[model samples]
Target chain A: AQSVAQPEDQVNVAEGNPLTVKCTYSVSGNPYLFWYVQYPNRGLQFLLKYITGDNLVKGSYGFEAEFNKSQTSFHLKKPSALVSDSALYFCALIKAAGNKLTFGGGTRVLVKP
Target chain B: DVKVTQSSRYLVKRTGEKVFLECVQDMDHENMFWYRQDPGLGLRLIYFSYDVKMKEKGDIPEGYSVSREKKERFSLILESASTNQTSMYLCASSSHGWSEKLFFGSGTQLSVL
Candidate 1:
């Protein structure tokens, strides 16, 4: 079974400060990881995905995520936070090809201006 | 840009009412998924269709059904809406590949009274 976990229920950061939302995963085989963001009353929007290759993947809205196999983590990050960047973040895992994604419980991010 | 569109942004229905949620994708993607989002519980997949007329149950599929008569469109049906069924329903689509990423619609907030 593939599962994803987001340790934090909420993360608060000041605008212009760096932000990180933690995620972890468990899978039977190699994992395909993804991060998505959801705004108020809106659907989730794709942030980035880690299939293979580099540990660090940059994505939309100046956000990025680092995949650490040893730690079994894929934490979403941003060099500097913006008030507009506040949203709900989710991490997901897929065990193998053609498998459905298993999503984390979600972490709500609040970037204060 | 890939685009997933849901028919309704918000809806209100009484308990025991039959509910229909429609989704369409303009990207010609081969996979479409239905998920419901709730506070704390996150996004739980209900059903997915990899091709026309082909549907698969996801993590949570009870009391819900889906239809995909056309490749670009997918519909989710609640046999009988209950108070617990009220949620933010999201529609998503992705290409037919292992590493493909998902694009999502704005979501439909269904309130069951």
Candidate 2:
């Protein structure tokens, strides 16, 4: 079965500093990866996806992710984190034949001002 | 914008009560999903439907059922609500495969008392 792993339970970053949240996946074939953000009292919002091409995928609110094939990782990153960027981040992957995603145990990002 | 709406943002139910959580999507999506979110567990899929009247059990389907009578709506049913079942239930929809981003609702926080 396809699965995702998010190593960190929480990540703290000073505001205006760069931030990264790590993610790795195990799948049967080439995977379709995604990043989602959830704010308090709300459902997840889609941030970005990596289906085929372009390892460096840019997404909403100045966030981006790099898909590394060899390492089977797709880590989310932002150039300059803002206080408003603090939220729960999840990395997900769907196997070649699956229609559902296997999500990582989300990472809480606390961007301190 | 795609919108997935759940019938309730919060619900409280006594143990063993029959509970139903409704979801409606307005984007003409072909896939609908029901998931339960718990702290430290991320989101676990309970069920999903690829088309009207077609449903599939997801990773965590025990103690849960689903109905998709119409293309625009999906409903989750808990036959006998249990305290352990209490969690945030999220409803989402997607156009097709997992490569497509999912549009999620604000989630229903269900408490089984």
Q: What is the TM-score of chain B alone in each candidate?
A: 0.97, 0.98
**Total backbone collisions, model 1:** 0
Most accurate candidate by lDDT: 2
Computed on C-alpha atoms, the DockQ of candidate 1 is: 0.71
lDDT of 2 by residue, A9-78 (tens): 9999999999999999999888999999999888999999999888999999999999999999999999
Candidate 1: segments with Cα more than 4 A from true spot: none
Q: Give the per-residue Cα lDDT of candidate 1 at A109.
A: 96
In angstroms, how far off is B52's CA in candidate 2?
0.3
Task: Pick the TM-score winner.
Answer: 2
Give the CA lDDT, 0 to 100, for residue B1 in model 1. 83
**Tens-digit lDDT track of model 2 for B48-69:** 9999999999998999999999
True contacts kept of each: 0.65, 0.80
Model 2 spans > 4 angstroms off: none
Candidate 2 chain A weakest ten by summed lDDT? A94-103
Chain A structural similarity (TM-score) per candidate?
0.97, 0.98
